[model samples]
Target: EPEVTQTPSHQVTQMGQEVILRCVPISNHLYFYWYRQILGQKVEFLVSFYNNEISEKSEIFDDQFSVERPDGSNFTLKIRSTKLEDSAMYFCASTRALGLASAQYFGPGTRLTVL
Candidate 1:
């Protein structure tokens, strides 16, 4: 079965460094999103992308963060300046349908650790 794959399940980085987390979303899926969960916090939406543009973004998606669809299958999230608070599990998700009918499928997650 097709599934989203995220690379480097865990990463440790120094503060203020740029980091790129990669994910390959399910084939034929149209909508994509990035969410993060702190060790004890609820999952928070960072951004959602469709049609090569951002559909919706949360306050957490600040200038230091960006996302891109480098190709037909690969989606990536880049943090230009990492902070200690950036440590969390970043999940990549996708859905074939839209609106309330669509169910998002998530990856295991890339655990970003900033020190």
Candidate 2:
């Protein structure tokens, strides 16, 4: 079975630095999304991308955050000027379609740590 994979399983950075999290969604999926869980909090949607453009985004995805497809197989999330609150497990998910019946496949997540 195909699955989403993230790079650098764990990332540590300074509070003012920038970080780029990478993901490779299932080869056949069409829709992609970015979500984050801040420690013990619930999973929060950040943004969704389809057809190479942002389909939707949550308030949490402020100017400091950006998403890009970059190429045919890669999806990425970039966080500028990282903050302490930015430390979380960022997840990448993909689905073939959007609907209640479509299941989203999630990646293991990339743990980001800010100091």
Candidate 3:
């Protein structure tokens, strides 16, 4: 089975430094997305990307967050400035089809911790 992969399984950064989280989705998957889960909260959607453009984004994906598919197989999320509250597990997901009914495969996640 195909699965998504993330780098720097764990990250510890200062409160204001920039951080880039990377992901590689299963081959042939098209739709890509980013989601985060705070320590004690449910997973929240951040942004969705397709055909090199953002398809949908949540308010949480403010000016500070950005996503890109720098290569054919790799997708990345960059945070311009980290905040203490930004500490959480960020997940990368991908699906073959579009819309609410498609199934998405998620990466194990990158845990970002700010101090």
Computed on alpha carbons, the lDDT of every model, listed in order, comes to 0.96, 0.95, 0.95
Off by over 4 Å in 1: none
What residue pairs are clashing in model 3? none
Give the Å error, residue 97, model 2.
2.2
> What lDDT does model 3 reach?
0.95
lDDT of 1 by residue, 78-107 (tens): 999999999999999999986678989999
Which stretches of model 2 miss by more than 4 angstroms?
Answer: 98-100
Compare the candidates by TM-score and give the number of the best one. Answer: 1
- Clash number for candidate 3: 0
lDDT of 3 by residue, 1-115 (tens): 7789999899999999999999999889889999999999999999999999999999999999999999899999999999999999999999987667888999999999999
The superposed Cα distance between candidate 1 and the true structure at residue 105, in angstroms, equals 0.1
TM-score (all chains, Cα) for each model = 0.97, 0.97, 0.97
Residue 91 displacement (Å), model 3? 0.3
lDDT of 1 at 76: 96
Candidate 2's displacement at residue 37, Å, is: 0.3
